[model samples]
Target: MKIKLVAEHIYNQEFSIERALNWILNSMTSEFCMRFFHEWLEIAESGTQQLTTPSWKEIIELKEKSFSKFNFRFETNSKDKQF
Candidate 1:
């Protein structure tokens, strides 16, 4: 999935896999990720929405809600690191 690949790419390291997974999980549900990407794409397509990336604080509060909702766990190795 897009989330997994992006997360791994950004957070790749032996000790950072869990952090990567957690961040990916956090981002998928974060308002900053969802609404921002949606609106950003819309704007990119039509040139009508705000031009700047929104603040992370816009979704800071949603972190807890997002975190509590997902419980996925898995093992990863360098073999799974294929781009």
Candidate 2:
């Protein structure tokens, strides 16, 4: 995603970051958004570089941690189990 943005000369374009971030925030579920906000706050308070130029591994780790509280059911055996 970052590569595509950079390749298209969209990285530093005016309001690009805000637009992209808004899109991402809008795409997320409320639960996921809350989790992401808490994690981001922790990183901000900790003065961590993980929020900037994160490596793929760091990104994956962050994602996993953010989702750790949720229990996902992939099977559609019941009507209520539908995503």
Write model 2 residue lDDT over 1-83, tens digit each, in one string.
63344324433343344564564445456657678778766766665654455457765666677763433222222333221
Write one digit per residue (lDDT tens) for candidate 1, span 30-71.
744566566555545554355554356644543433333444
lDDT, each prediction: 0.54, 0.51
Instruction: For candidate 1, list the clashing residue pairs, or say none.
Output: none
lDDT of 2: 0.51
Give the top-scoring candidate (lDDT).
1
User: Candidate 1: where is the Cα deviation over 4 Å?
Assistant: 1-15, 31-75, 78-83
Worst 10 residues of 2 by lDDT: 70-79
Candidate 2, residue 72: Cα displacement in angstroms equals 7.0
Best by TM-score: 2
Q: State how far residue 52 of model 1 sits from its true place (Å).
A: 32
